[model samples]
Target: MLPNEFSSSPARVSGMDVGLRSHMQRIYNRMTVGVLITALVSFYIGHNEELLRVIFGTPLKWVVMLAPLAIVMFGFNPARMSSGALRLSFIALSVLYGVSFGAIFAVYTGESIAKAFFVATSMFAGISIFGYTTKKDLSAMGSFAVMGMIGVLVLSLINIFVASSLMSNVIAGVGILAFGGMTAWETQRMKEMYSSRDNEEMASRMSWAAALNLYISFIAMFQYVLHFMGQRN
Candidate 1:
């Protein structure tokens, strides 16, 4: 009986690991899709002069720029929302972000944008891998990163009206660091949140939530990297 119990513990642990991997995979798949959607939409709008002008040249641009933030702050309640609703919201947010970001093409050279993206991708991948494989607890670091992000957001808002290039650079630099820390923290959090006992609906909700977290971190990092690395067109 002792031998049987001991042998079965390893099997159970292995099974749990497999489940965790699958859960993480699903989250990453959703995040990849969201990123692709945002990229395609941004590219399309960026390339279309007429569409770009209609969106960015008019008062409606405020809606395009602010809607995602509004929705994320007020409407994104994963606990209250179904998986389907969360999925739709995620897609909608991605589209809104793409619309908001379309102006980047006009502001920055293509080579600069590509370089920034590659750098951001490499940084994100490395940090995320470290977060997942490391044995250390990152809760403290994650908390600090979240606080830094809030401070960055406030500074960014203030800088909008201040219009100081130096301030903008500082904000961008801080944003890149904060978002990089967030990516690592979030990756670890997602890994810790997985459970083999979760039902389909619960699992789906968790996946979407995790995906959104990672997606936001990736996008924020990319934008900040671009601010520093991108050449003005």
Candidate 2:
């Protein structure tokens, strides 16, 4: 009887594990699609140097560059937003982000971009898988990762005007590490956020946020690794 009970416990746990895997799989699938769309759009623009300059030329460049940031800021605002509003905001942000990413194509060879992207994807997948599977608490790591991300952003803005090569390299290196950490933290967060009681409307918004976070982290990490690989268009 004890042997039967022990065997049944493993089976039950396995069943629960399978269900959780499916939920996480859906989250990843959505994130991956969003990333692919963003990449394609960005690369198309990047490859067309003349088109890029025409749209982002002179005084207009500031608007073009800041558009995505504005939309993302809108998405983050908790007040006066419906689920549909959030979804549209994310879509707009992703497109604008792709446009911003056009510069990557100008900097890296196509083959190198591809290779670096694959590397980043592999790393993101591995960490996220562990985060979803592990029972250990990751909340502490998440807080640290969030602080690191804030530091990276502040430094990146300062470096934009300074154009210091050393700062740029430091930003790239630390940016990769920060996002890598966030990937795991965000994945675990997503797992906790999901539940059968969640309404479709609320879940949709939650999923969009999860997808956006993962997509952004992957793109940032990929760009940094690409820089390290010294990819030249």
> In each prediction, how many residue pairs overlap at the backbone (N, C-alpha, C within less than 3 A)?
0, 1
* Winning candidate number (lDDT): 1
Instruction: Give the poorly placed runs of model 2, Cα more than 4 Å off.
Output: 1-19, 76-80
* Residue pairs whose backbone atoms clash in candidate 1: none
lDDT of each model, Cα atoms only?
0.90, 0.80
Candidate 1 regions exceeding 4 Å error are none
lDDT of 2 by residue, 1-233 (tens): 99999989989888867866666676678787778778888889998979688766667667767987777675555235676776677777778778877777877788888889888889888988888788988898888888888999999999989999899899989888888889888888887877542565666667777887888888889878887875675
TM-score of each: 0.97, 0.85
